[model samples]
Target: MDQNSARQMFENGAFLVVLDAPTGIEFGIDLDTWETGPLFKGLKMIPPGIHYIHYSVVNNDKQAGIQSGFLHSFVSKEVVVRRWCAETEQLYPSDHVSAEDVERIRMGIRDLDKGLGAYPLGSGPNDSYARWQKLTGYITPAMLAQLLPPNGEFSSATGSVYEDEEMEEAQKALHHATAEPPAALLDTTDRFNFTHSDIRRSFPANAPPEDIRKYSRDKSWLLKTLLSSRWHDNPQDLLGELQLAFVIIFVGQNFSGLEHWKFLMHLTLCCAEALEDRVLVSRLFVPLVRVLCVQLAECPQEFAASVLEQDNFIAVVLETLVLNVYECSADEMRTIMEKEIGGLRKLLEERFSWTLATGRQLQADADAEDGEYAPQVIHLD
Candidate 1:
């Protein structure tokens, strides 16, 4: 940052005060991380916006434990305080501390300035702050409240076991017959309020058979339903949720986060009919393409190799989206669509060797072969 910018941030940026955190633990805010030192308090001069604060506990051997984090929206010159719980080995709001003590700490912040680190705000495209801003551009405070857990905490170790309502009738009956203890039934860990979607149940029960079949095949109706019910017809909110899910997966390293991301990809990419809505095409897909580009470019190689192998779920969805847009859009819209899609195609090919054109051609060949298969009648008839 330039001197003027640095001075502005120093005068106005928010503060994070972490109290009694152990030395050598991995601590991070946004994209920057550090191994804590003896005097480590927290970050200083953080830009006023949404940021992910995360950490991993370290063992005696210095190996890190499961990552955990939460999103916080900071304001100018605000001080947010958190204390380490030695028994639980986690960070929690410093509610138990007396107000006077906190006030004293706030008053003495300048004395502890040397213990704090400045937010990483380098002036470049690939800088930590810039990339983080791109990743979270659409995320709003309202979206965060709707999707995050009630306590605003996220941990890789936190997960939900099957609830009785979600269990099969047969399983419930068996459990009752065996008289399993309630404690053994499910873990008490909290889950994020991700919008629920099931492909099998995408179509409405009251729809006619033909309409149901059409809805199942097209998924446009499902997208509309979710837009109305879950996102309040705001496409940007849906995109915001997508950004949140990916951030959770990428930063928290949580498996449930990955599941949420996949469901959203299916919901957004499978809707060919949605492309007809100019508002959706411009407001959603335009930024959606940019979001996916950054995510795929920054995605870890192990994740690509393991979770999304060659011809994986993303490739299939991208193929469907490309074909649908080409077949459904008008001539004028194709230019903008092609530009965004072309950039995505180039990135995929360069990074993962995923050729969408080849995939589309192969799918066509397979469909043609299926069409050629028929039952024949001979002279016996």
Candidate 2:
């Protein structure tokens, strides 16, 4: 936005990040970091919304930095504080300042601004703020608390068994999923060694009897069933868990985070009505499909049971592409999406008995070519 607009937006309150350490430790906000001398303080005018603060310990050995990050939300003119810990090589948050301190900082912001660098609003260091908002708009404070726990450490609360071995297993699973599963089932380790156990542990166990029957009948049914059921009154309650899973996997550097993304992808793709909306389609659909293409390829059997259920996964995706994508997307976006969708369909057909094209034909016939997609019958047994 223009300077006047920025001034009006920022005039309310600012977020403060202060490093009390003596200057050796490295620090950064979002994607950019300090390469020079000690940046003891940073102050900036922030738009009211959720923002991310990612930082890592600077490696003196000329290698990659140790990255860890967190998310925060700001209301209008709010003051947020974080102090750097040299020994731990991490940031710890401080409570909101008293009224006297707020006045003092506001009055002295001029001199303070001189010492501190401005948090990049739009351009230089971190322009990925828009993407961040898109990915995390559904995340609420209660959701964050549930996912992050008290200390903001994912591994601790979840008892994550993700290790190098698990990573290797994940790699193996990806290769297997991308390729065809062998005729003979290999050792149990090949199937159960990845982070699936950790992910399954976190799933809601006390689903309704019918939902439980659906889950027992097909493990893939568990996700949609959980997604449809509410733990409380809120429709969006499951989103918090999904958000935590995202933060852990994406920013928290945990491999198990993909489980959350997978569940989210299923829910999003199932929303055929929502896909019809131009704004939601442009913002969410393509990105989600892009992720889903890779994921579905990586773990086809993970959703194979779900595919056998009432909703045909492949048909919904294709229908979304054929109907919704062209109208909402530009030529370039449209081309990339068609290519990705084609790849996903090809992968499913080549590797499994059910052909995606057949599903599409069935769905088209069921819809009477009216644009609404329907599922084709499948006999997985």
Regions more than 4 Å wrong, model 2: 21-26, 31-36, 95-107, 123-127, 151-235, 263-381
- Candidate 2 has an lDDT of 0.50
Tens-digit lDDT string for candidate 1 (1-381): 788988788779998888886788899998888899998988899999999999998889989898877788889988878888888878886575668878888888787788888998888899999999988988998777777764467888655222323544556677788986433434344667777777657788799999888778678888888989988999888888888888887777776666667778888887777778788889887788889998888777777777655448887788777777777656656556768889998998898777767435745765776677534447774
Alpha carbon lDDT at 45, candidate 2:
71
| Number of the top-ranking candidate, with lDDT as the measure | 1
**What clash count goes with each model?**
0, 1
Model 2 worst lDDT run, 10 consecutive residues: 187-196
In TM-score terms, candidate 1 sits at: 0.89
Q: How much is the lDDT of residue 304 in candidate 2?
A: 53
- State every prediction's TM-score relative to the real structure: 0.89, 0.53
